[model samples]
Target: MKPVFFIAFLFFSISSIVAQPTQKPLLHGKNWMAITGKPLAATAGAAIFQKGGNAVDAACAMLAATCTMWDVLSWGGETQALIYNPKTKKVIAINAMGVAPTGATVDFFKKKGYSFPPEYGPLAATTPGTPGGICLMLANYGTKSLKEVLEPAMQLAAGYPIEAQTANSIERNKTRIKEWPYSRKTFLTRPGEKREAPEAGEIFIQKDLLTTLNKMVEAEQQALQQKKGRKDAIMAAYDRFYKGDIAQEFVRGCQEQGGLITLQDLANWKPIEEEALQTNYKGIDVYKMQSWTQGPSLLQALNILENFDLKKMGYNSSQYIHTVYQAMNLSFADRDFYYGDPYMPPVEPIKGLLSKDYAKQRAALINPNQNDPAMGPGDPYPFENKTNTYLELLKKRSFSTDSSDRQFMPTHDIRTGNSFNTSTDELYQDRLWRGTTSVEAADKDGWVVSITPSGGWLPACIAGNTGVGMSQRMQSFVLDEIINPFNVVAPGKRPRVTLTPSLALKGGKPFLSFAVQGGDTQEQNLLQFFLNMVEFDMTVQQATEAANFNSNQLWLSLGGTKMEDRKPRTGSILLNDNTKEATRSELKKMGYTLSFDDRTSGPINAIYFDWKHGSLWGGSSNHGEDYGIGW
Candidate 1:
């Protein structure tokens, strides 16, 4: 997509709309901005920027650090990113998502008595993607050496002070971690004691993980010593991880633990850099990753919302919430059925799916009065000159219209939402990322990056001495065509994932780089976050902290192995506890079964380019470990 700059009039930057103070102070930077899931991780990005590396380099640093800390992800998880390369003046999607390995198929899962892939263990893993993701980004767009970018992560692995959130999670899941001997040895510092996991502030060390990172760095160094070009040297490291001893150990460990990945699977897996999917909303070009991720759902949401007068609706007003929720329900409904591995597909009618005519058609189906419990995927085939052959399958779909209060939601009320509630949050999280994390970075050179990486999380099973946790992304695949033919488990095909990173451009320049973490709830929060800045004029920080609502009107992308467990809870809405009682009552009247949580802030992180001021505005969510550093 060409940069649609030279709009008749320029959109104003963040202004008085953010009159209310945000919980986190706005971070301003004239040269660089770095933000992610943890303070240390962000700091790692900052260090890279200080070292004169570009946005891609800093983001790679942050990715490595978060994975090392198991900040909702591990080395073996997936990485999906959207980067604005100023030199190219284009948004590029990094499809670092791994594919289901050999022997991973619907029949394989069914015979194992699973309706879906298991939530954890080797069975739930696809090939690891983060290592390749990091190497690729660094080699292509970054000026830094792999050795430099990995230094922070390597340091973290050698024994960084562990935080309470992660430490406690390890303690709580010790039983499950114990099931994997390698994991037990690494995570459970005191196997037989009351607390097998390390305590808060303890210097948690991963000797094996450090060694693994060192090996990759060594590979890069060896290639460099041989006079290899920077990119080739990084690829050398990439090859070592995927085709050398690393892949061998990972395969041996995986098969030993009942997983399907073969060394061939690791060798064959490669990351793709493609043009980002785009849609114009009021002249701003918004970009998202491909269908393999849920990113496009946000693009579709924006298309539908474009037809509404959101500014007049007022932020969080019953009408606003209802309209936005309905739009997302429409978008996610389509995402559930149609989004999948675009590389393999019953070719997802993506061209048709993003067509304005199709968006208008979907928008027209939204009722202004109440939630549409029967919301399902729309046929985009006609827009692309193909008759939809799966309309019959869509009709056979099932969802709950009961609107009953789910005991599960209320339990995740204020306390659960404020901080990580190990049990349900862990489940809700990869359930990731029903478990995942986000990374955002930008530099004065116009380079910007947004990444939502997920998969291997706490209680993660280790892959032998590789110190890498296997990915649970395989759980994202469906076993039956009735659920999603495009997303059914198949060897060498990617599981449709919840990870998405977004970028927006106005007047032919980078306007925003942002992403968030939450399983299926990703696009819902991102859609609102974007509107908060564009429609409501909230500052990036204000938008990041603003209360948002979630709709559970689509099939969950993560969770259990049973079809019933992944079923949609129609008309169920998660509202911030701070919502006015009247607003809550009105939503209730609109057929929404409201659940309250104080922190629906997305744990969102973002960098907004204020061209007029020639500065970067950074925003990190007011909850969890999300943090940012700007300079």
Candidate 2:
């Protein structure tokens, strides 16, 4: 062969022989590690670890930083977390999700001509939760003081180099931001200029937010000086935020903007710490948050998926995708109908939903040949040996297929056969794949934490001088009984949220801790990530970079001002562009309307406990700006 041709041939052969590599390198550590949505926030967590804090303390630091950075969430948003305590040898769930305020009933919204909760503004808010959540986690689990944990966030609030992602989001949503006086004052650095938001790399300072953090730290300091214990001191700061001056200012600002929250509502709200739900996948015990957050659906899907030989089907194969999609659809159907605030009336049938027998019954309904678009919530009440009190009501509930017209209320969108409406498709997609930041941390002391905290994203309704953004979580509730008797809108009820964190334990030791961004796609991507690690033997980094698909066959848990906007698209699937053409063809033949993306592995972040090597291996995907630090 000619010399030039031979050289070209050698290069081609080498490229073809080598396996594809991950965009981000795998992280390795011996003592501890921290991972989150942004570089600075991850650095914040790392700082806490360096200061000798445990995983819980580091996780709190990361959470505060992410909220401060406006990385698709804020301090007023809800926080859902799963923490593995080394001493207790157990995983615990932190339910810091806020409740609806007084006058936030179905009748109140209907009277105002709203089909569902408004997508944005004061009307959509639940009482602030993240502030209380941080205090609770720090008080009960963390070894650090509130002053120590809030240091990084307070610094960021004072001023930090803003990234283009958040800066540009503010610019784009400036019109909405202007509607709220405090938001306009905090976000619009240049009132009349063409570029009102902080420029990328510009120092973005939030004086009001900084003041709030200072007040919290001051309250803690005062309590400590008075000889209060660490936990008691933390609770003192919590009280200041909820029942003291902070709460008064927050309520005044909220009501000024036509919101429903009251001082009583703020005082009544408190974070709950409960036993985390778990399911044994093979010999590994997987843990998730409770049903109120669409978390147990992942467990339910795991149970249904347990019936299949997933490894035999091959990862991302047509058969694998089909079976997984069917399982998720079934799990989500039950979630839409039965999951609700357990603290209120109409107790959720959680025991039944998590039952293996119920999973088997759900699994039996899946069609091997194609998608079953008419699947509805199963009768799990029977599995628990109790009569389904709402069988008649469930019967009255409308069921629709890909081409059927359906309605739960007079204002619900009326479908007209399979003539797919394209006008609102973009908005629908936005809600399905909406973004949120994830936090994961672990230490050699055997502490592990995974959290998927969200709400109060860009265009937030800033609550007065407090500088706290109001949560837009009310949209997750239904206004009608027939649609979801359990999830109906009512004062003080928590909505069924999409934020879910995951952890797995093997042989009574930490195995893996993981979480992802994206609304309804949260569980879908997490399931695939877990399977890649457990069944396919992929490394944590490789699993995060692997291709994953999303199903739009379930109702959206975020956004959408009307039922029409939240409606599910039967048989719609989002496939990674790397998907095999053969697999796509097979799915298309089975009644799926497919879409494609190059990045679908969740922008996921994870930590794998390499017990064999006695070390921690971290994974951060290339899909987004997720970063991790290890030492």
Candidate 3:
């Protein structure tokens, strides 16, 4: 298949009306700008930019403000970031994801007579990585101090009116929130009241959370007074939570709630900064987090689909959706079967999965006439550097065995528009990342960052008066010994999380940075958006607003449950209202089950850096985490 090089001749022939629509164009500016899930967060970032902070500083500020959005993200959360540093002209990935506690072992759960590890308590909680993650960014790449970046979040946390999204999340998880006294007092309507989530526009005050943030700031100040350098002061603030009094308090809270997290787990916890997993797609250099996340799924799918004529198939056509969806299934299958923590001994090399040769082999399996509903993982072991546990154990295990009778389902409200409820095997059961949110920022100097910070909800217990909520990310780990190697429970291993923020490059320059708020759909949504930008030549705004199509057709569900029991219904494709009716009908005819919704994925926030124009264009959706501002 021939790739579509820049077809300038075709573009030159387009009519003027088609060139520029009458609708308002994207928010444009020559200065720094931001696109975030919440308006307050966006504004806070813009304010930081106005105060002469670059993209990293703005991102820290925006994320701090987003913390007030307790229903979307929390003070106790996880963060994964992909940043482009113009000074070095390099892109980096930061893994702020927490690791399973040393005490969290597969044997422990089995001996406890539980089918899977705990899903909603201290046992499920990983040490909170968000505070350390954001602080690391600020200390290394930002111009402001930790206190400055956290100012807006602190102000908002003190007293900010609750928005619709947050209020809705609060009401949905109210039952579990009431179980923890600290959580109930901090998140609910009143001290001991059982009232529902406050209505939109209702004043919501988090005095406890505010105090916690202030204490961190105070710790930073104390370090500054001790004659420490800026970076040292930031580390001091980070230590206040992980290695100091806050850590002690969290350990106590976990003990009170029957959680297994200990002081050692909190003290040893630190976010990792590593090179981003990257691939050459067409001429664009695409980047994502390593195996600890589903980020590689995007690159794998891109590699597989590169052998096809996506543009020629026509956007949103049945042929287009089928081809992309099939490729996605294959990638997700591999993700479930092979992808695992890189910290583990031997696993499939990410490079092998993203290789063009592997793509040729994987792509050759795609059938144009029909959908391969049960497509499983391919053997990438031959492409590996060493023996892979997954491949070694493959024959001994039942790759096709159906464990549907043990499907794990967490009850959540349908009106909340959560994806798990729309599926049979509980696609939402992957992790407790329902409230994840994202933010992006860029400045004229070419500093760019895409960060997704999430966690800190009430369904799980809180860390006493410290106001930090425990992360239930361990829920993504599989209890089965023979399951995917990447998701196996191991001491000090980071769970395979879905928190991915992406950055793309063109001609070795930062072209775009983006992220979204969704569990398994995060990578899927990002892949479609990236394709929209390069293949279809859609503007950032057009791509951000474009109808999204995502599929979780892979048989293996999170937590090692099989989805085969719902065959014919095992896999599902979600389409937005804007998708062509003809395409939907064609998809169904292709033997694919589908769901129609206007909002197919979480709100996507993106920033496009135009070197030619020396301008920045920010785009956000009309609803659900859509907020953008530029100077």
Candidate 4:
């Protein structure tokens, strides 16, 4: 061969090898890493790992950077996390969700004669929880000093570009931005000029945020010099932000703006530490955050799915999609009616609802061809058929049934009956359903991570000052008598959140860590991702890129502009061959109102450890406006 031809051949061969997908290695010994919504946040964590910090340290660094860069997502907002240590094989759960101030009362809202508002301003604010959560994580798990971990975030905040994501988020919330002075000053360049969009590589700066972080670092150092333990020092740092100088200013601003938060509320606030909610799905150990939000709802959805043969039923078949929608509807109804702060009252026994036996029973209620408009909660224990007795009891309760037109169900004619089903003998089978046998082993190295961050979109826009904007979060519902349908309407009552962060393990080895950002779609998106990974056997990227779907079955009232009476939401279901033939037709036959949009589902940040390859693969969703991955 000619010399040039030989060189070209070599280059082409090398490129082909690099282009093929490679298995990620399992991170043995100790691995430090972080995944966030912004590149700068990831950079901070990577910097910490390079400097000899562990996961906790990297998390702290990432927390600060995320707060600074993705102000709407982080800041003093609440956070939840799962942290695992390999040597000890222990996982701990952290609850960084915000709480209503003590002075909040439902009666107060009743007297005002107005219903609760859902905007994130002074009216929608809760006590900021991110500071406390970050501090606690560092105190319990970190070896790095506070100053060291926070330095990166502080520097980045001093001068970082407004990424396309942040700019878009800012523009979307422009009306709400006008509620707070600080938000207006920081985001809006002029009084009447349209907000500018930042180019991809442009650096955005927030001098005020840098100042806040610097003050926090200094206070932490001072506390350490006084011989306080790590926990105490961290607490002191939090106090500086919430109850010290910042607190006084924040309280005053809220008071002047007719908000309800008080100084004592800020000083008395503390992050709750709770046991993680756990379950086993087809042998894989699935873990999630508990009540006050929708964490348990995902478990309920999974449990319901387990009762059905998803793959055999065919992907997204009308029948399959209808079943899944029914499951979500049932779970969501339970979430709205029963889920609340555990401190106030015990949440309903959701675990039992998601149990295998329960799922089987629930599955039996499905009428594959028709819409069951108002399926009541199934009896907790209806195993033995009491036909006579059950009928008599039903008569006493004045039971009634009604048929509701289906919305969002697929049309049977959309796909020619192109069955992808292989015969039992020809079916490609691997140990896909081996069950999460090694999940317990993975738990040994697991960490419980929970984040419940809050922001004051409306209040901050109106307030203008950073300090003033921070106060609005605490003014949400605190009254016992207020009838706020969503959690955001009531002060101290937790917001109905879409803040699900999760981890999955196989064979006592760390498998994946994942999270996403969407107002009410967080847990729903997560449930789909989990199903895609386990049941569908998809790669991380494929699972994320796969068309996503969600149902408006539960909070039909909260569907906003997307709500429909006769059709199920369309775009929620992916239009793949498998789904088109199976889910779409079956669901249409069942009758559902559906609408379709080409919107990105949600952004999922994930780290997958491939034990077989001895490499770690990290990925972030490119769909939802603002996420990316790096080596």
- The candidate scoring highest on TM-score is 1
Candidate 2 residue spans exceeding 4 A from truth: 1-19, 399-434
Task: Arrange candidates by lDDT, descending.
Answer: 2, 1, 3, 4
Off by over 4 Å in 1: 1-17, 399-401, 404-415, 418-435
In order, candidate lDDTs are 0.85, 0.86, 0.74, 0.55
Shift in Å, residue 244, candidate 4: 1.3
Clashing pairs in 3: 340-486
For residues 267-288, write the lDDT of model 4, one tens digit per residue. 7777776777767788777777
Residue-level lDDT tens digits of model 3 in 1-631: 1244434433442222134441225878798878886778888998899889999999988888876666445776788898899999999888888888877888987788665556676777877888989889998999998888898888898788886556656766778888887787776774445656677689888776788798889999999999999999999988988888878877887779777778898788788889898888899888999988888899999999889988766666788889988888888878876777787755556777877788789999988978876687787756755455565566665544321332211222111233455344322332333345688999888898998777665465787877777777776777775556657787788877777899999998988888876666777889998887787777887777677786756532333322243222234677777677787778878877676665554467788888888898887754444588988
Candidate 2 residue lDDT tens string, 439-514: 9999999999999988788889999998899998898898987778888999999988888999999999999999
TM-score of each model, in listed order = 0.94, 0.92, 0.89, 0.77
Greater-lDDT candidate between 1 and 2: 2
Q: Tell me the RMSD of model 1 versus the true structure.
A: 5.2
Give the TM-score comparing model 1 with the true structure, all chains together.
0.94
In terms of lDDT, the best-performing candidate is 2
Clashing residue pairs found in predicted model 1: 429-432, 429-433, 429-434, 429-435, 430-433, 430-434, 430-435, 431-434, 432-435
Rank candidates by TM-score, best first: 1, 2, 3, 4
